[model samples]
Target: MSKVLYIKANAKPEGESKTFRIADKFMEAYKKHHPQDEIVTLDLYKEDIHFLTVEDVMVHMSNEVEEKENPMKRYALQFKSADKYIFAEPMWNLGIPAILKAYIDYVSIPNITFKYSENGPIGLCQGKKALNITTSGGDYTEGMAAEWDLCDKYLKTIMGLFGIFDYTTIRASNLDVIGMDVEAIVNKAIEEAEELAKTF
Candidate 1:
């Protein structure tokens, strides 16, 4: 059975957060489809993901430095071991949350995730897939704000850096707009998520 790392980034709990609800619905279907697959849920808000310092960066970069007791290694190890990933995050200020970013920082090691080559930087982590889930109050997927829609795009790009280019997205866009059927929009996204999960 393959391992699926499910990362929940919304700070608010299930009943209180719309993003959490969408993630929950999608995960439920995913579990149903792949019961034998090992699913590890990493709640980023609750987890203590430490931010990297200059010293930390130096330690990772330096081959002579024997930094064996690194706190980030466990997080990095788990990420490296996983065959697939599902990131359920809320779009904040046209980007991702600080907590999720911190987690990414911890796991993104130079030789571990990627390496520099003559052509360019090449990703080391191989044969991995990802699915990014997000909810936004404003519609950034279309119109003039599309340029400002950094959440999903960032997810794809960063994951691609680690050799994960095979990815999909489930976005519940424009939730806070006036006179909009938020429930129907969420339900439609949930349906889409379920369909994707079957193949995912």
Candidate 2:
């Protein structure tokens, strides 16, 4: 059975977060479809993730044995071993939350997630898929605002850097717009999340 790593980055209560609700639906459907599969939920906001210091960065850059026993090695190991990954985070100020970014930084180690090659950096965790579920207060699909959308593109690029080329993105937009049908938008995304999880 495949192992699924679900990263939850929303700091709000689940009931108040559309992104979390959609992720819950996806995970529930995934369990129903693949009962034998194992699911690991990592809450970034609640996790003790340290900011990488200059020395810490140097330690990872060097192929030293000390890096092998790093206290934060768990995240790197989890990312490397997962068969599939699901990232649920809301768009905050046109980008992913700081906690999520910190988690990414924690896992994107030199040898753990990627390595420099003769030509360029090569991703080691290949052949895995990622599903991104994000919510935005304002819609940016077809306007100058699109230029301000950094969440999807950033996450997608990070996933590719880690060799997770196959991915699906779901967005709940205009959540804060006045008179907008936020319920409809969120519900539709929730439904889609369940459908995608069946085959994810």
Best by TM-score: 2
lDDT by candidate, in order shown:
0.85, 0.86
Please give, for residues 1-200, the per-residue lDDT of candidate 1 as tens digits. 88999998877887888887888888999899999999999999878776788876775675532244675666776888899999999899889988898888877777677777898888877799998889999888777899998888888898989988898889998899999899999999899998998989
Alpha-carbon shift of residue 161 in model 1 (angstroms): 0.8
Q: Write the per-residue lDDT of candidate 2 for residues 27-133, one digit (tens) a residue.
A: 99999999999999998877887678887677667664335467456678777889899999999989999888988887887777887889888888899999999
Positional deviation of 89 in candidate 2, in angstroms?
Answer: 0.5
TM-score of each: 0.93, 0.94
Error of 2 at 6 (Å): 0.5
